[model samples]
Target: MISPRAPRADRRPVVRSHHGRSFTDDYEWLRDKSSPDVVAHLEAENEWTAHETSHLAPLADAIFDEIKSRTLETDLSVPVRKGDHWYFTRTVEGSSYGVFCRAPVASPDDWVPPAVDPAQTLPGEEVLLDANVEAEGHDFFSLGTFDVSPDGRSLLWGVDTEGDERYTLRIVDLASRAVSDVDVIPNTAAGAMFSPDGAFVFYCTVDDAWRPDTVWRHAVGSSSGADVTVFTEPDDRFWVGVGRTRSRKYIVVEVGSKITSEVHLLDAADPMGEFAVVWPRVEGVEYDVEHVVLAGEDRLLITHNDGAENFEVVDVAAADPRGLRDVVVPASTDTRIDGVDAFAGHVVVSYRRDALTRVGILPLSGGIAAGGVLRVGEIVGYGALTELEFDEPLFDVGVSSNPEWTQPTLRLGFTSFVTPSTVLSVDVATRETTVLKRMPVLGGYRSEDYAQARDWATAADGTRVPISLVWKPGAVDESAPAPTLLYGYGSYEASMDPSFSIARLSLLDRGILFAIAHVRGGGELGRHWYDDGKTLTKRNTFTDFVAVGEHLVASGRSRPDGLVAEGRSAGGLLVGAAVNLAPDLFAGVLAGVPFVDALTSILDPELPLTVIEWDEWGDPLHDPAVYDYMSSYSPYENVRSDVGYPPILAVTSLNDTRVLYVEPAKWVAKLREVGAPALLKIEMQAGHGGVSGRYDAWRERAFEYAWVIDTATRGARDDLESSAPVAPTLDA
Candidate 1:
């Protein structure tokens, strides 16, 4: 079928210069998203993409339906015991969102989550918030934070109606089931917390640039205009957040940037009190605090990177905040400390060791309900930490839902690429773990049918990069080639941990081998892994991804002819940069909300998050070195007419504040002008994350995966076409 002729974006050149380096952007005119011509061009591009992918509609639909069929439409989460209630969320059939509910606890000390199912509602079930009911008239919906008061009498929730990050804070009387008539606080950020007595709540608000710069304390039922500004960070580079410690004894006001952080503590018992800094902000120090009672002393479980890039845990007295004696010294270059959680009897240490997530339990001795320490040395007081063991070599596991400090069991979540997410309850004292539930996959499914493994590719600098792989047992043949999709994201020190995806099953069954490149710039291996991939070393991120794509071919895992590269947001930048560096290495490139115009965006400090991102991308505007370094790799500026670029799909949203839609819109326009097979699909009503709602999300994945399969297959039509799973009949 002949694809529709795409609309041509008029060349309206805009000269942009930074540190004596200048470039002309012909598609810069497309940045005016509000203009009718801009909308028409995007709409026309959507039409052309639809025409090009018309034959894959059945394929997309089949995958979407498969996801829906495999997923349990109605399900209930494990109830978490908080005060006198067991709080949980349930999803119903035909519901776009979840319903937050709670059931009365048999006893306050009962830590086990109720054996409840959405199909059979438990007695005395009280619904606190029905997101479906609340999201009745909105194009986008997100629950930034939802928390219950200390007495469990009221609920404070934050909601974002649009794709924008700002949320509206609301209060509801749990007993009366009536929304409070008080004026709601709008434009609040994440990490909102209630005071111990439940009279007041502290939340953060963004400045003009959409940075969460100011934190405020507001009386629950009072007008938002009467709220008091508790703290404000004058620096545009730092973002602020407020939250109560896990112990519920201290309220923390955290302010930090990419490289530095400072935390202030307030006694939760005192609502109108001043906060004291635990440690003065050091130039390059980043630390997180958690209140804990150790050996009869009030202390903060501090995880800081004083000199250790991977960070180490130290116990500092709450009274003598400046005293930082080490409890657990940093591991030599292996384990990267992610975070810590404090409980009455123990501290849960979360870190990444050996490139996979690891969780350990550090037990406290001689601790009581009230505070008092025996005055032992920091290192000798706490017993040796015990590591939680998981059989799978590659899996994502972490702690959560541990509301009560005195609770005996720790709630954990675990999932691997081929394993359905399982909720586990661990007995703190016994070290025994009990699997509460494995998410139900409705359609007939078996984990044994799938396979997952890890491989490594050596970089140009001799650094080995790990690649996580997943596929059906017979999905690929080493003797021949198979359609492959390589995904990577190497910015912000984020690790793309292995997790199960029902939608991914469709691709695996369709003769596709999916892999994730644990490239540099990510904290997978350690902090240095990320350090070597950002700013001046940013090229390592792109090159590492290309190296993995090349390794996958050389290792007989997959061939270059049928390889596709995929990434979203920062990952989009990864995929985009890789294509520019080696266009012929990939059969197609799927970039979602890509930061392709890295140099252009970094030069403008006024854009949302632009200034705050300097730590990650470097100061390109003022630093001539950074400017030249970034200009050499910025995807948009590097698009050349001479190269035979791959078929590219650039997906973006109009309302996104993080990575502007204009980046991909302009990237695709330039690619098309250069005679490359490229298309742009815009989600007009969505934000940074595409369309909300599980159904919409499923359909979106289906659209992208269908395209990935089609394009990857196009490169080697006869490689595995005979073995590919056929689209299911509509009636099936």
Candidate 2:
């Protein structure tokens, strides 16, 4: 066992922030001094990994081991449910696999894993379905999203090998208990949807650049010989990503760059042929095509965004693909379209206006404006509405009394920070709602126990960045300082919304305050927010995070030494940069599967994920300006050997395809050799996600919280002393 508090004299000296100058300014100055010729040469040398034994590798490994040993105990996989029963697959007693299922629970206390008999094999418990099962010497499995046929006679699933995202489609006959491989294009199987006619299957696949490209067709019961390439993308610059419409013959492909999108229609029979462009691209603006559905036999309902406003719903009549016309449902900027579900006679539209999401129904025959909007429920957060299928008997039983009796109702699920997920079935006719499922709260937890608030912090450049704070009622005050954890991810246009988590509740129950920094690089405030946090403006994310930390301490919400910063992936980069830029602001840091080597990772176009990420980070190799900008703050390059930084736990996975293990490995090693007290934990079997199963995920959370608690209360030095062994020499 390794201890945490051993003397570390060789730790690199910390680089101090210059007085009267921001870190970003200092970085700009550093970039200006690099010779143009040397910069060009460095840009040309895009090799991500040159030397393997840099001083960082060993220390990273040690830290990874400590975190892994402390945090991971159980395998945490997603739960799959059907009817009255729910099933979860996990590795039991080491390498052996099993499926655990039991009666459905209305609340958390009622939930329990089914008991298994060692001597007897139960139905649906034989071979566990996994995503990475084909990998060597590992019991890893890809639990691909699966769907049962309408008749419930077969199960269709997609599987991936190791980190190779390309999926292999497979089906198993329920009665025969035999698995059959489906004919799918090599590297072309993303989401699989069973056709309404049930004669063929439709699935999408990605191209070499990782952009969605084609949707293929495969006849039922046919092997490799019967598979057909249905729809192929028109060009490399534009990819075809498919969404099913109500009519089985029609599928919508959202095609365009990150800044814009157009919808296209393809004949289900000959999908590979040239598509009829249903919606043409709008110039000089960024738009997203969404909620595409068949409105009627000759009309389609589509949601689109034009540069000046949020998304709006529009109706386009089915015509020659080259001559489609806008029929109805005129666009408006005041109401932002959130969701849509189209049926034969009616279409349900959910939109957000003035912070409230309202649901409305429009009849194809009677224009959308004529059909008065019906209010459903106001929610702080809204997820895209989806339909859930129930057995014939169950569907019929709820027909009369169910508010959704106007038509076969579609269940819409919604949630918020305080509200657990709730499923509601809405009748397309009467617009009535029926509660189906509500996430059960544990005995001690209450929605009113904590309060959620949002505020803005001005960054060093005077940019207003949004921050969400959550703390127990009365726990935060001037006299009593609360331990705080500030989280953020400022890249990839991903939004960090408020949602309930049991693990998070565990922290709140312990009087810990949690805040999420909705920095500029995210989609929380839409496109403009994301634009400011990526590429040349990437440093804004870290600065915004630091500003939020300062606000929390300065506003009397939390103490400086009691604050801990946490983030994963790109956000992990946020965590690393903040700790390095302002170490005294945070007591501890948690960086998981971090993209710390930003410059080196982006420079190499040959790596699996690099080419696809150019749009987000900019092509540093071909552009000198980007190279200099990225290099200035690239976590690995900016590591200073002279500064004393806060203690950090850098978590990563050896098998992660997105952020390679070498990143954390190298970072930890370098930091340790320079005499910084850092820890690293590498999951041997997992990928980008630290763990695969639910139990394992919970244990990992427990370990992380334990570290945070120990650091905030018992003190980092005390915990380090108890865990680390005393050493005279500082050789990592």
Candidate 3:
């Protein structure tokens, strides 16, 4: 069979000048996505990609089937009690989306959620929203906000049909099951919630750059033109978000940048009232607010990084937020206190320690009961804080789904590399844990067959970076290095924790290993880790990933010729830079929606979310030093033709606003210029996240994984030939 010719983009060189420096961009024409020529080029690229990987169709199907078979197709999520109803979602065997439903509460004292059966609906079950039905006739559909009103009579929901991050919010009357014509809001951001009385809906709107910069409040029965602007952030660096406190006592509006934040609160009873600032904005200090009652008085719990690298909790009077305060949970160097969720009986503290997410419960003194009455044996001070311990040495656990302020049980979610997602309910008074639901794995999976472990890599600057390793116990070892996929993402202080993936089973079952490189830009160790890997120190993120790949190969856990590097989004940037730093360390590279053209993106403030990103990456437009530094390690700028680079696959969506499609398109074009066998797949109907439906997403992952597997075993499979006939060319 003859190999198809690669699609070559025409060179339309455009000179870009910044900080007394000039650069020529050959593929800048791709930036104009609306141009017919650009669309044709993208379509040609997709056609070439499909033709190149057509041999992996059978493997891709097998992998997708494995993922579907291992998953319980028809299942119901554990019901969660909120207000007067127990709400849950169900997924039918053939459906692409979930159906949200709720059942009436049995009694006022009924706190235990009703058991839901996948085969049948519970008694008195009311369907709130059927996403599958709503998604009909649309190629891409995303449900943004699914907030039910406090009275349970009204529902506020939002949907994005175009995958552009802008949503259309609408209210539906539960009794009549009719969408309100008067309350239709278009071009809204992702989150929106109904006011405490369910008469008002608070939502956010994005600016031209796609940043949520304004918060608005709309009357339930009013038109969009009559919606009042609650608050707006003039600074492009800050984004605004609106939500109510878990206690349902105050409406909260938060304005935050990458490094700083300020919160505003208003009495929930007043729909047209002024919101008071909890604390004035401070540079480099980030804090989150949670309403709680202590000593029979209203107080706000603040988890802040003010003068503390790792956050600390402070208790202050809610009536006078900036007044005198008491340090409830003091700052610690060994732990990072992320945030706090307050309830009537207790406060759940989410923190990170020993490179793992952990949760602790702190009972409030003089706590109020669900009936709005004070407990009889309440005290003034707080009870001892105790951690919700788990036996897993490496796992990710956090508080989840306990929306009620006076609920007795705290819902927590726990998962690890081998453990399926498990939801648990912990009694606030007795510290007793009850497993509410453990996601079923239909393909007879055993945890004992797989193993998870931690490893450390020494960076060039003597910094120790952590690496999370997972594989089949008997299949992967140092004595016989297996085909390995090393993943990394080190940006925005996001910590990539270990979680079980049914799709990953296809790899491990085939004697392949998977690993995560917790590099410096991530919050795995603490804020300090992220601090050392951003702005001027951004090169540390790339060097750290290269070090992990070197460590894996040197330690005999992976062969130099069988290692595949993979990352998505910011992590995609990681592998991109790593390959430039050390081209021979891996056999293949997979970058999904990668920020490869970092310098180019950051230099332009008009791009989507670019102004808000100045804190994560320095202000390259204004700072000459930053521009110079970023130019040194930016993946696109540093692509070298001299090195024997590995085979590369870049996956991006046409409508992705975060990192525009042109970044990868330009990067792949440059790679082809160097004679590298690079494939670019563009999803014309998707956003930053490739496909919407689960099955479509699974197929996308399978295609990428098949490429990884084929590249990793290229040495052994070189003799195999494709018996299949050539496919027809795609129309441009």
Candidate 4:
């Protein structure tokens, strides 16, 4: 591989004034993505990235092959019973996408899912949507909405071919197997669903700021132009979404912002009727509503954080949401009550406790009949909550895919760092759990060979941050540290839970330990953990990450010279800021679509999703204090020329609406000006998630892992280059 000179971005300085502060931005011109020069520069960056890392092509290919070989190429997901059909998805060996499929239910009493074989189709199997067929000519394809009508006669599905998130929805008649061309709706948001009777399809559309603001109801056979606007949110900070209740009784319109939420419900039978507000909007108070029946009386179970930072559930009359209230699940400081799903005789509560995701079932004393009336003997109050337990010390478990209103069992998904994804069904009546399916890993994989544990790091402010560690036993330890990858994403209250990945196994096999820095701003230790990390205290997210990295080194678990920090999206922002705060802490950094230029993006209210982000990151545009605070730690704004930095690889997508591609491009440009070894890889035909296909995603991961392995190992060999361990291959 021949070395190529890095692409130099021509600087044309632009002066901007904000809150009495003047800042000169040299790479601001790159933000005009429509300009031909910008395109040429991005292309040049891509070429430079390709040539600079050309030596790792074989390693990347080997990793890709290892991932593919370890995965079950031909597989079918566990069947989820919905309506009269058992719905599932099948992936063929050679296909890049899944084929949506369904088969008739065995009987009305058949609670167990039937066996499915990937090699052969089940009897009476119907292919609802073949994504491979729809994605034939397009470079990118994303299936957003796929909801079958209650009667199984109509299918309302949405597709995004450009990866920009604007989907085109189409309804197809299952009886005739013909797509209704007249019902095609374009420029819509991500989700859509059919009315209970299949008479109309309810969906949402985005406003100019890329926020879903309007909900529309379109008749089954009517043109999109004839669609009626059901509701529109006037507040730009709030995003509106439409969904159906589990009981299929009402269509719900959920409108929410970063700090508050308000729900509206309309009887599904009344498609053209107005939606009534369940609870009016109250700033600083967030709540979600779930409909349930208690002793034959209609009730609305509301989960709210009004007075409880960790949230609590209250049951109220459906007719009068706030009239009569009964505490169902009281808020606890140690636990974060996320959501609740109601059924005929049971309710599933999803929450986070001990920094792990969990699910608990609360059984109701009464059951529903065929006509949706309670048939069992009337009881007093709700039964005791039964939390589902897992054997793994660190695992993620939650209720999933139990759509039926009268399901006797609750479907759940469980996974850990060493455990493959497992689907389970727990009988609500008996509390008995059954494993329906476990994702297959083709290579010789053993859970006992790997170890996962929890560690804590003390931050400068005396706050303890949790870390999840995974490594092969007996391979690397305290005495002699090996190459390590530390990953983190601490924003939007999103938790980085324990989950299994086949591609990660390649790195683990190569004696590289993987760990997660559960820093602040994430919803790992409850709401307060997230609250203390955002807004004015956003710097904690970065400092917490640095503390975790230092802990790894101080504990001798990771070599100081072999630690690579990786983050994506907001996590990208995390690593970017952490590097600026402690440039000598990491050997390399991998930031994917990072919001590095935070102050610049947040200062402009017109940018996509900027106004809505004011809640998470304070309004720098309006507040002078916020401008100074953001400028103090903003990655691109804080980069210093005097400090020597580790090599960095910033990956971004051209069509990413969430974080514009110019962000990483500009950040890399600034890093390069400081003589930092920085490279940018821009996906020209992708979005924030990168390429759509499974194979393409695998290739992308392989490329990134190869770079991290090479960089970490090369950095590990400081004085004695030949003494460093060679990255193990499949044949090694």
Candidate 5:
């Protein structure tokens, strides 16, 4: 493995013009000295370079080659079945293309090909989708959940190119073995359900700003048919999107930005018509709506967070447009509900209490005053709900930790770091799950010795910010220093949880400590936590992350010289600010696909993602105070040559649309010119995500961890030598 290049020992620290001044004073002086026009010109040039390099056609091809070479030994995709037979997909070598239903895992631990004949078992053998599978190409492909129609005549799959947020809907005619590409829409297709009559398909679309736009109905066999917009925003200030119910009679629409929301109900059959606002926005409250199901005509079971105490499920009948009465599940103040799934006469409600989440079942006929709740099982993590068949005897529930469901008999498949993926059958009534086939695990690894730790740090403002650490046991010492890597993405109410990982294990086993700072501007601690770290309060997130680092050092878990910070996209903003505020705290910084040019990024509302992000970062142009605050800490605008700074490795993709590759490119150029030790690496074949294939991803991570370890270890070695005590030895 290639180690990071160390700084020269003879390179004495340069004494600049400003010395002995506070960081604030140094910042002001640096800003006054740099010409604004020069900064703008550099930014423009960087943007041009990003655009030109991104259009190079060979980039994606090269990336695909890298992905294939690394992941070829492993079976990355698994075969799944909705009907009698099985189907699978896999990418070919030296190509960015994949073939479907070519390989099938007959049983667990069976590495050799099955004795069964392939011609009889395989369905529509190996079809080509994308000929050129470059990560940066416009036609890059992604494999989503397969939705087979009730009669098994057609199958619907979603494809996204370069994580564009928008997806192209495709349909495969099972009978003819032909594929047809549908209209492109903004929102990703989470669930594609065919109408009972099979005349149209219902899917959701999000706007360019990343807000849910409307649920659309597309007629089959028509290229230019009128698209019925089922859900739409009630006002320009708020965004609206709809979710499907099991019965297909009620469509739930949620409206609001980050701080507030209202749940509305509309007849699924006639969704284009005006909807009856079910839950009105409550003042001074921030909440979310989910698990909306239709119990009967004009009656619905709705789960909502009113910001009072916790989320609760209310059984309400839409008798009056403005009034709704609780029926089975009453509103509660202490217990929080996560999800609700209605089947037969029982409603399965998922709730969280005392940091533990579980599912409970309750019968609908029982009144709210007497309905009994029966605890089912502990929820290891949030799982997706799939409708097996319309009005079938049983429906399938996809959950982690249930391995039996991966078998061919169960017909459902799931993927994780340790688990390749397996199909399974689940009995809803008995809650019995069986594995069909275990997808082969790739790479030489196991997930047994890794662990996750949740801790808190007291911020400068006396607020407690939650931080999650994941690593192998004995990776770090409380009394000795070690290479510590801290990661954070504190923006947009995005929660960074302690999830399973295989690639991360590569770092942990190598004696590196990886941690995630769950600071404000995230929904980890609920609404209040997110509210405290967004807009003008965004600075709180930076301070909170710094406090976590300080806690780690003060507690003897790690030293400042052993620390390296990493963040991406919006999190990139956090890394830039944290480094500027306390350069001495980190030995190396990795800002990958970062948005360092915050002020300029927000200035152009016409950009693909700026308008929606305004709700999170605040509109600096509209508010002069916001502009002043943002300008004060904006990474590109805050660079100073008078102050010493840590070495940085800035990584970016030429085709990233969300953060834009130009942001990091411009920041790196500015920092380098200003005498900061920074290196820029542009992945010619990737987009926002540095790499696509599993093996390629692991290699990228390896490079990152190696850089961090070398920097931190080298710093420790230097410190030890400088502080060594003088000793006298007898001559021999």
Candidate 6:
């Protein structure tokens, strides 16, 4: 219990550059975050991580009261009908946010979500936004556009009291709960929607590098300085957005990056008009879109990737918008599609086959259906379609709230690693289903008292990978290696499926195991496992998460002295490049908000979203072979000051503008200038999905599950030393 003296961080060099090299950063003066000597070195690394883990404040308050007693502190969510209302969200038991409600639709074709007891608040509901009374006097709040409108009597939302992902917007009214003095608007960028006669709203706005690159429109009660701009995206690797078309009939707008996409459509009943595109940014081709209604016309479907490297669904013709054709032609397990919704009777789709997450259901009645044909022995949206069966062999499903394009019902949402997320509804013309809720985990939780499987690993170029796990099954000994905690994030093609976690049942009720590697820059196993782990085959996402921590220490399910790796934000650059490729195969890592100074934020094009992440970390300014492959694995330029590395921590968020609390305050000041065992906390009023209520995110997940179970059972020492400290010094 001693180790305190930490905050050194003063080095100030700063040279940088790209294409024609140049380097020397020395914690680039902690990127001057409004310097009071960089907020006194991040408040002295938050008071030396609160006097070195103030003895895991009673195991982070008994893992934050066993995640607030298996959470269901007054619940609700699962209503969602839309137009004669029903919506839902509620949360109230000592609330720290939730409320957005709705109600009035027990009839006019009511799609049943009311067997009542949603914390007993339904008959005449309404609420529409109360996020703890709009997060009273903020210390980081968040929300970002809750949308409503289309005659639900205006709502739009947005807010953010701190945690810098911009936000603000407003316009409330919903039958006099009043709040609109000329709409408000400010900063922006997290989508906003409405138009289709909810009288204009659109939203988005970010350039100066924060990247949402202009969208605008406004009008509602007007005065965001007369809004307008409608669409801008002058390609800084594309980034603009706008929504509509859950068949409220077109208005999309899109534009993309991280490998091509373009979309654009507009006419949600022509709100101040002008939008068109439907497909035009093809460098590495990617697509998305939904609007259906076939045979009664108006089409679009899309899902694309022209050559179908695991993407196909075609359609086109929002009145022959351009005649593309096919209709779900590509998946022989080359799955990966990921989205498509449409309805007035069927569609769902979502993809990703063998690495799990499915969805299916197509049905636009097989006849001539506008000839956007799935012809040749049609079998519906592919993986032999009509899907929904889920008995868990590694679970995670999707298509959650089907917003009525003439709803026949869809909802769904399942989960796995020991189930508990549930939510069902189904019946898109009798594929039946209907559970309607399952997340009431409260103490007596059991999915057979935990245990999950699926394995794999291999990789040093021979690929394989997979992993998933979870534990408490015989607590530990099926012949050794226990204190695990593998986890990984891979990146952008997201997929980290197998859900469930009442704060991971306080680390599987203490014997701690938890896994999930599923590597290759993520889309689970499709799109060539995220194109072989990103640009220049980005060190195969840190050698496939160091080949699953050396195949969880060669299958004894982890114990290269009890592993302990983690990831966040691009899987914290995949465990900061698998701790410089394998710091003696981990003992503790975490990382959170971590995009570890990737070659000085991808050779800085004015930073934020760095030129739309040049399609996922590649254009290193002007490519000197992407500035030597992002300065050879940029975890703050491959931290090596005489290696002895391991024990890291580093969660961050000084209002993170997406991975920028100066990349983990310069990778924990270069892992405390090489003496290793770094710590750094920082959230100082949150951002980048850090703390915005729920008891400061359940005491930041009980201080990272009490430091990944005290660094995987107290760092069995391979010089990845651990002077036992698990967490403290938190405020904001």
Q: Write the per-residue lDDT of candidate 5 for residues 618-686, one digit (tens) a residue.
A: 787577677767877788778877777787888776556677766776676667656777766666446
TM-scores, each model vs. reference = 0.95, 0.72, 0.96, 0.96, 0.71, 0.31
**Model 3 segments more than 4 A misplaced:** 1-3, 366-379, 716-732
Error of model 5, residue 65, in angstroms: 15
Best candidate, TM-score: 4
lDDT of 2 by residue, 1-732 (tens): 542232222232434232222222112111221456323322222121112113444433443344344322233323333333344444433332234322343443322233434334345443434432433354355544365554555667765545445667777776686787554334544577655455667777776556567766677788755677766765544556665564445656666655556776666555445656765786424433322334324555555665335555544446543344342334444454554656555555655432333455555344222333332222111212322232211011111111111234544665666666655656654556666545555454577877777677788888777777777775555366678889999897777766666666656756788888888787666556677888888888899999999988887777767888999999988988888888888888889899887776777665545755777887776777788788778787778787887777777765677787667655765676667767776665677766654445655666676666655544534555888977778775
Q: How many backbone clashes does candidate 4 have?
A: 0
List lDDT for all candidates, in order: 0.87, 0.59, 0.89, 0.90, 0.58, 0.79
Candidate 1 lowest-lDDT run of ten: 368-377
lDDT, candidate 4, 221-330, per-residue tens? 88899999999999888899999889988899999999999999998888789899988999999999998987678889899998989988888899999796777788
Model 5 has an lDDT value of 0.58
Error of 3 at 436 (Å): 1.0
In model 4, the runs with Cα more than 4 Å from the true position are 1-3, 366-379, 722-732
Which scores better on lDDT, 1 or 4?
Answer: 4
Better structure of 2 and 6 per lDDT: 6
Clashes (N, CA, C under 3 Å) per candidate? 4, 47, 0, 0, 22, 4
Runs of candidate 1 with Cα error greater than 4 angstroms are: 1-4, 366-380, 718-732
For model 6, residues 135-192, the per-residue Cα lDDT tens digits are 8887878877787887888788888788888888888787887888888988898878
Error of 5 at 538 (Å): 1.9
Q: How large an RMSD does model 1 have?
A: 4.9
